[model samples]
Target: MKRPTTGRSRHSGGPNVGRPGFAWALPATIFFALFAIVPLIGVAVMSFTSWSGLGSPEFNGLDNWNKLLGDKVMMQSLWLSALLTLLGVVIQTPLSILLGVWAAGQQKNRAVLSAIYFIPLLLSSAAVSVLWRALLDPNFGIPGQLAGIFGGDGNLLGSQAGAIAVLTFVGAWQFTPLHTLLYQGAARSVPPVLYQAAEIDGAGTMRKFFSITLPQLRNTIVTSGILMVVGGLTTFDTVLILTKGGPGTDTTITPYYMYRKAFQSFDFGVGSAIALVLVVIATAISLIMVRATGYDKMNSAQEGI
Candidate 1:
């Protein structure tokens, strides 16, 4: 038997009527639309045209996209970007997590350690590039001087492998500290009682880490991995200042490829297509990673609460 609601108890209105504080949503929505949604739409539209940065864009359908299929340089850039992402994820992720766990355990004198770890991230990428350039200079650079000492004529950043190594070194240096901070935060959030219980159960450090810490930090690891992957894919400034996509395109990533296409070759059509491809790849990979890590389920559980 349904009871009839009185005027004071109920009214004809939407669910949000009772929530008077939801007014903030409107402003956020407007901001997102203006900044994010509008720019994405513009990029999508621009990706289909041939604009010279001055003239009106003429729609060329899928010609730009088709050009991607046969572009050797673009293919090369894609390969390098993929390699960078792979190396970053493989090298940085576990190291960051381990260091983060260690950092969390260091209750005393952590400030000094934190400052040391954060120095790389604190420096600008351009500054790091300039520094590394001087260090790796062929004639009078530290590395070259070291090679001279060793009687081995070696030039870092002169070969393809060297360039890749330099790029990876720069990336890991800047990003690992931030990633460690992420894991450190996550590790600290873990309940102390969990460790006590594990200790009582005779669980060793390795066992506890695998059965407890790793499981608890699954989300942070995924987030850090995604960031590393995205940064690897879109990295341009360091590579630009360091190698200029040179020594025969050894260090060229997709973003650098896009820059060369648009500004160097004056091919806006192809550049936009590459940009769109980058967007799609980044979006798809991020979604896949989030889904794989069960982040959506976690969000859903939080929402249900």
Candidate 2:
């Protein structure tokens, strides 16, 4: 006997029903191929060649890589980049978390406080650089005047150590608000029951924060730390505008050095190699952070629960 006809036939659609998934993904695939994949491949290929912008690229295998290994300036740039990343993460993380927690717990003036905190983020990097440059001017800047009052020179941008410190501080100042916002969202998502339970147990604010708030924000902290590290490593505009990697390459982080090599010196090959190295370093660091924090496992366990 023939089966009764169904409203829909599974065999009729078969796997064809899922064929449209590729169609939906086509635009994104094309975009990634054209922009990300293509450029990455081009950069990788160019890293092995001596390519002046105007001339045809000449294959010079390992020459650029060899130079990169022994170049003192390049080494300095890499070390400086690492230092900036460390300083930025160290300074921004705790400050942001504290500010975020405080702002989230506020019963009044929350909006106003948030707005004020985000003002630095709203300003363009160029603008911030210019503003700080003026404020740090040795001749007449506020910082310089304060230094003079202390019977010291006000030329913060004139010394290598001072330039590095100022740049690090500027980076932290510009980005801490963004971290604060991230932490605020994470803080607010914590279950109210957790805090209440802590209170009932006679836990004070600091105790509850350590026991509940921080533990809940582990993923966010890791995520933000990675982002801040990457940002610090790739920092350019503010450094470019304010210091121009001045005081004898003291502030010339890897990205700015890469820029100088590619554009100023017209050495695209060396620059491409540096760029690839940076990409590898950043990716490895991010992976290490995720692994150390057990971020993936935590996410999976959370989902399972």
Model 1 per-residue lDDT tens digits across residues 1-305: 43333223234364334433545567999999999889777778877888887878899998888888898888999999999889989999988999898888756767579768988888888998898888777788877667746345557777888788888887888889999999999999999999999999999999999999999998898788888888889998898999998789877889999999888988888888888889999899889887877879989897543
Error of 1 at 252 (Å): 1.4
Q: Rate the local accuracy (lDDT) of all candidates.
A: 0.84, 0.87
Q: What is the TM-score of candidate 1?
A: 0.84
- Candidate maximizing lDDT: 2
Q: Give stretches of model 2 more than 4 Å off.
A: 1-20, 148-151, 286-305
Score candidate 2 by lDDT: 0.87
Worst 10 residues of 2 by lDDT: 1-10
Could you tell me how far off, in angstroms, the CA of residue 126 lies in candidate 1 after the best superposition?
2.1
lDDT, residue 25, candidate 2 = 69
Q: In model 1, which runs have C-alpha deviations exceeding 4 angstroms?
A: 1-32, 148-151, 289-305
Q: What is the C-alpha lDDT profile of model 2 across 1-305, one tens digit per residue?
A: 43323323335555333323335668999999999889888888889999889869899999999999999999999999988889899999999999998888757798689889999999999999999999988788987667646346778888888888889888878999999999999999999999888889999988998999999999899889888988888899998999999987888989999999999999999999999988888779878887977879889897443
